[model samples]
Target: MLEEIFREYDIRGIYERDLNETSVKAIGLNLGREMLKRGAKNVSVGYDARLSAEDIFGWLVSGLNAAGIDVFDIGLLPTPVGYFSVFNDKFDANIMITGSHNPKEYNGFKITIFKDSYFGADLQKLKDEAVSTIKAKTQIKDDFRAIKFDIASEYKKFIIYQFAHLKNMKLKIVMDCANGAVGAVLPEICKSLNLDAEILYPNPDGNFPNHHPDPSEEKNLKDIKEALKGEFEIGFGFDGDGDRIAVLTKNRNIKGDELAYLYSLVMKNPRVLGEVKCSQNMYDEIDKNGGKSFMGKTGHSNIKKAMKELNIDMAAEVSGHIFFKERYFGFDDALYAMFRVLELVQKGINLDAELEKLPKVFSTDEIKVETSESKKFKIIEALKLELAKGVKELPEVKEIIDIDGVRVRFEDGWALVRASNTTPVIVTRFEAKSEELVKKLQSIFMNLLDSIKKGM
Candidate 1:
């Protein structure tokens, strides 16, 4: 059941079947056993606002307790809260029960050991170890420490204190929770700051009846934008797990890189890291502002890990996984991100003005081409080889950057082909300083990818 359900980034499956009690329990036991071996005694657990979370939490804790591991229950939180629990307490291991932006019927896990992401390869290793020990059922503890602790208060207080001047900022704001987990803390944070705001879908419900919980998709944000009625200066939307976020102004929808440029302005020499998927304008803007910018791989875990190594103040993905090592914990928190934007507003700066100043470029919003899960990575390997041959055989290419996947930069534009780490798709994006040039680049890349699909 575990193997069949495992995805590249997280484990997810249908409840009561693919994610049955026995398999999930065994997963918990294996995870707990691994944590113990790694010298972790106390571990923190949190869950999203899913209907299945209550039962999943119970079964998951039961298995962990069976392995003689101590568990801290952080009830009904965004995925980021589980990360916060690791830093807030002395504990080193954390587990978040969530399927992130997937459908409401879906649910799964995002885990970390000693504040490091237990992702991708590590996740598979855990499943493999559990499967190898099919008979490894330890004694289940009669009672475990399932305590309710309030973390939002301190998190709210920290941001409020950080932006103390925003107490009476007197700016109208609109937030679209999309019926996800962000509903728990954002309103409290906004209220504490005395920031006037209207919230849509503030109640934490798993069904997500108002709209799909993904904010990155433009169509999904229609209700939230319409709700604003051009009365609010800023808007925020969060995915189901709350790790990913999106921003909206009256005129335009701001991407993560745009937020980074606007947010980093208040600081002096702020070092920022961005993913390979970010628009070139974001990197150029950071450089122009006397700040440092590093283009790295995409993934919250990867971006967060890169921040520590690079000692960067902030990091963002095109999909809006914003991390702030500036004034708070170096994790992606949408509630905190909203306050940061409010703080920017309080300073009398325009939200879209910063983006407006940047040199305009035409870019794609992450085009995904579906491939067989087994063939996707191997096809990426084949594509990489093909790129190497094309560069050597063709004269049009100026440079190729294969740090994550492959990015070919021509004189007029650039095109990227990368396999998404989380899902079964080869992600592609194109950009150019001119709209017409961008369209040309897109056509070229699309034709090539189409031919590749046919050949494969």
Candidate 2:
């Protein structure tokens, strides 16, 4: 019944194999029913530049039609634009077909309901309904009407109008789109802003022939950085869906915490929120600036919901999901983030200079420890048991925060080990005051992990 692809957040799997015509159609029907049951009148849909996205869309349309939901087709746009549809056209729900950072072989859907993310139990409910209906041989209408929607232009105009002041700033910016859906909307926005922008792999190539569509990895920025030989001021990179962003200065890529710190300085009395993965500097800077800060679990949906619950105006995750309720709608829009940086530059701020002021710390980019799907959680559980039992035995770990998973805060800095909610791996990152401390922490954690694995 295609339950394998239905994850805690969204539906994702390989093309034609895990997400074929039958399974996808059934999944769409389930989403449509969920929309109807939740009292949504229509759903807006968009997709990335994947070869199979075109055909898979047809199956999705069929399911929406069967559920009697009107379809507004905004073809080949970013997920953020799909998110905009719910607000732009007053639609009840939005769905984006994208594999996100995954390779060309993968494709999936990210869903939103009434502006909030549709995930967790909500996702499970859809899977259950899809499977049960398949078992019962349920009946649904086979027809759906999709009208071409010009959301890209409208979204572009909105962004340009909002940041019209940054136009003609004469600040050169290099962008790497990774041949994803941003190809349709990003360049237009940049043009409107009068940004001296140079784009790499801007065309919508589903194959991603150059590299995978993930900017979080520093290696992925190789070409873009090399292109920045002279003083380009900054560089911007986008993921497949264009909701995640990687901000770069001339010297180094700025993590999400760095962005929050800069933004907090500009935003008056800003209430900032950073996910557990965010650097400690973000929180410290916000506190120093007389602004309040809070920490939450990582995930775009989780952060969005947290923003609403805690009345936070802005939020950021290490993966570069930036949500702004400060002045506009609360959602992660990478295109918008690019312009905001331009405005910051216009205000006589240098991104790298600001970051250099912070105390230096040693950190590692996210290290993914691959494990089997069935064994990932078991490993975490066993490790948790060891930590709890030998709290005094292991003097290295001073604190254990299992808010999302386990984030151990130490005196020097901190280390985190969390089972990825979206992937079958233990995602880890460590930050310390010195390089030696970072290595010490990483070794300590890895040794514990190896020990636990060997039943030592």
Quick one: how many clashes does candidate 1 have?
0
lDDT of 2: 0.84
lDDT of 2 by residue, 153-212 (tens): 888888888988887878778899999889888778777777788988889889888888
**Any residue pairs clashing in model 1, and if so which?**
none
lDDT per residue as tens, model 1, 1-456 = 456577655688877876667777778888988899999997888888888888788778877887778888877778887788787764678889997888887788888888778777778898887676555654443344465666666656666777777786777878888888888877887777777888889888998888888888998889768866767777888898788888888888888888888888998999999988887777888898899999888887777778989999999888888899887788888777877887787788887776787877888778888987777777777777777667342338888888788788877668888887766789999888888877777776677677777887
lDDT per model vs. reference: 0.80, 0.84
